[model samples]
Target: AQSVAQPEDQVNVAEGNPLTVKCTYSVSGNPYLFWYVQYPNRGLQFLLKYITGDNLVKGSYGFEAEFNKSQTSFHLKKPSALVSDSALYFCAVRDSRRSNDYKLSFGAGTTVTVRA
Candidate 1:
């Protein structure tokens, strides 16, 4: 079964410092990885995705992620964190084994707190 695991329930980082949210996945074939951010009651907003090619992919809000095929991991990163960047994050994966459907399996969710 394809699944994603976010080991951290929350991440605390100081403003202007780098931040990272860990994510690992298990799948049968090449997985379509994505990172999404949710604020309050709003729906999740796409951050970035790793389909093919480049290992390092950049996305909205100056966020980036590195796809490590060897480790089966896709970790989100930001150079300088901001208080506004504080929100709930979810890591998702679309399993290739299931061709008929495009259901995204998401992590439980992780909250990022940026301290001023």
Candidate 2:
């Protein structure tokens, strides 16, 4: 079974400051990682993903994530955070071992608060 974990339940950051949301994963085979953001009463918006390319992947709204195989981590980062960036973040993973398993297992989620 594959699983994802967001270490912090809530991340507080100041506007214009760098923002980070940590994530770790466990999978039997190669991992396909992804990051998503959800605003109030809205569905999850795709932020970024890590498949079989570069370790560093860039996504929407100035967000990026680094996939570290050694550490089994995919941490999301934004150089400068905006108040509008405050939302719930989720880390997800899909195991490649199971070709038929396209389903993604997601973390509990982390709430990010950006204060101006």
Candidate 3:
């Protein structure tokens, strides 16, 4: 089994500033980590994923995450913030080894507010 945690309920950042949403995970074996964003009243969208290879993975909209195996953390980050970036973000994880069942366990979610 695998689980993910988003420590912050919300994150506030000024436009043009860097923003980071913390995430930590736990699993039995190697883990596959992912980041998703949800706009109000819509479905969740994929951001980036860490399957293997590089520890640093880049995704859409200049967003990136670092896969820290030592700390069991996969934190999302953006070099600069935009007011349009305001939305709900979720961190998810699945075990490297899969069964017949395919499912993803997601974090509680973190609301990001970017102000002008």
Candidate 4:
């Protein structure tokens, strides 16, 4: 089965410091990985994705992720954390070979707290 796992329940970091949220996946075929962030009372916003190209992919808010095929991991990274960045993060995956009925499997979610 295709799924994503986020080992951490929460991540705490001081403002202006680098932050990372780890994620790993299991899929039958090639995977389309994605990172999403959600604030209070709002839907998730797309951060980045690893489709078919380079390993390192950049996304909104100066965030980036590195796709490690060997490790089956895609970890989200940011050079500097902001208080506003405090939110819920989710890692998701979709099997490219699957049909449209295949929905994205998401992690339970990690809460990022950027302390000022």
Worst 10 residues of 2 by lDDT: 94-103
Give the Å shift of residue 106 in candidate 1: 0.3
Better of 2 and 3 by lDDT: 2
Clash number for every model? 0, 0, 0, 0
RMSD of each candidate?
Answer: 0.6, 0.6, 0.7, 0.8
Q: lDDT, candidate 2, residue 86?
A: 95
| Per-residue lDDT of candidate 2, residues 1-115 (tens digit) | 9999999999999999999999999999999999999999999999989999899999999999999999999999999999999999999999999887589999999999999
> How big is the positional error of residue 35 in model 4, measured in Å on the Cα after superposition?
0.5
lDDT of 3 by residue, 53-98 (tens): 9999999999999999999999999999999999999999998777
lDDT of 3 at 115: 95
Give the CA lDDT, 0 to 100, for residue 75 in model 4.
97
Report the error of model 2 at residue 90, Å: 0.3
Q: In model 1, state the lDDT of residue 3.
A: 93
TM-score of each: 0.98, 0.98, 0.97, 0.97
TM-score of 2: 0.98
What is the lDDT of every predicted structure here?
0.96, 0.96, 0.96, 0.97
- Better by TM-score, candidate 4 or 2: 2
What is the Cα-based lDDT of residue 83 in candidate 3?
94
**Descending-TM-score candidate ranking:** 2, 1, 3, 4
Give the CA lDDT, 0 to 100, for residue 106 in model 2: 99
Model 2 residue 44 CA deviation in Å: 0.9
